[model samples]
Target: DAGITQSPRHKVTETGTPVTLRCHQTENHRYMYWYRQDPGHGLRLIHYSYGVKDTDKGEVSDGYSVSRSKTEDFLLTLESATSSQTSVYFCAIRQGIGQPQHFGDGTRLSIL
Candidate 1:
């Protein structure tokens, strides 16, 4: 198993507020990613990290930010929450290039 854990299984916040979601892994994976799942777009990557303090933006990275300061932890932050940003967020970890990724249960976020 990947041994991944996502915090705050559910969240509801007002628009314009800042929110953060965290992902923790017990396995020492080298790569970690944050993705948001929506009805029409499927799964879209928000940000990813190759190593500690080495992070890059993904396809839908405009309103989101990510940080990875340790091997086991990846954090996703919304600069200012919006209704359009309301979706299920998932965190995945992979050992390397061709390895399978393991995902957490995901956090359900609702913005009103």
Candidate 2:
């Protein structure tokens, strides 16, 4: 197993609604991340955690938030979603930062 899954591979939301996406990993990895992929930006990091409760925001963290309290699960929440937030969200993990990351398929999020 690749040790990961994202919930609701497809979604449609209004311009300003609260939405949450789930990322599940089976293998115990040391790092997990949330990233959004768009036509122009390619992939941009939203947030990540090195361990339980040891997370920090990333470059595109505005209006978005994340939490990881367990080794196998990471959650991303859009507090007040907007149309501009429509994009494919991917979850990733790495045994260590120096190495490449393994990514989940992706959660297709559409904020109206």
Candidate 3:
């Protein structure tokens, strides 16, 4: 499991609402990432953090934002929920870019 944890294993919300997901890692890695899983497109990165308070946007970052205030904790927030954004969100952590990333169980979000 690589000591990674994700909260609210599942969630359901109405469109236009705000949602936040949390990821925690006990590995103390420098790199943390958030990704969304859809049926056909596989997994796509949403945001990532390289270190404490150091984060960057990923390919699909338009409606999503992320924060990492400490090495073990990373957060993902959806500013406005939408049906298009409803998917299984995953959190991963790695010691470095070249290293393998270990993923958390994931949080399944549904927008109604």
Candidate with best TM-score: 1
**Which is superior by lDDT, 1 or 2?**
1
* Model 3: lDDT to the true structure: 0.93
Q: How high is each candidate's TM-score?
A: 0.97, 0.95, 0.96
Model 2 off-target regions past 4 Å?
A: none
Worst 10-residue stretch by lDDT in candidate 3? 93-102
The sequence of per-residue lDDT tens digits that candidate 1 reaches over residues 1-112 is 5799999899999999999999999999999999999999899999999999999999999989888889999999998999999999999999999998889999999999
Give the Å error, residue 49, model 1. Answer: 0.5
Instruction: Identify the runs in model 1 with alpha carbons over 4 angstroms from their true place.
Output: none
Clashing pairs in 2: none
lDDT of each: 0.95, 0.92, 0.93
In candidate 3, the residue pairs with backbone N, CA or C atoms under 3 Å apart (3 or more residues apart, or in different chains) clash, namely none
lDDT of 2 by residue, 1-112 (tens): 4789999899999987999999999878889999999997899999999999889999899999898989999999999999989999999998876988999999999876
Model 3: per-residue lDDT, tens digit, 1-112?
Answer: 5999899899999999999999989898999999999999899999999899999999899999888888889999998999999899999999986799899999999999
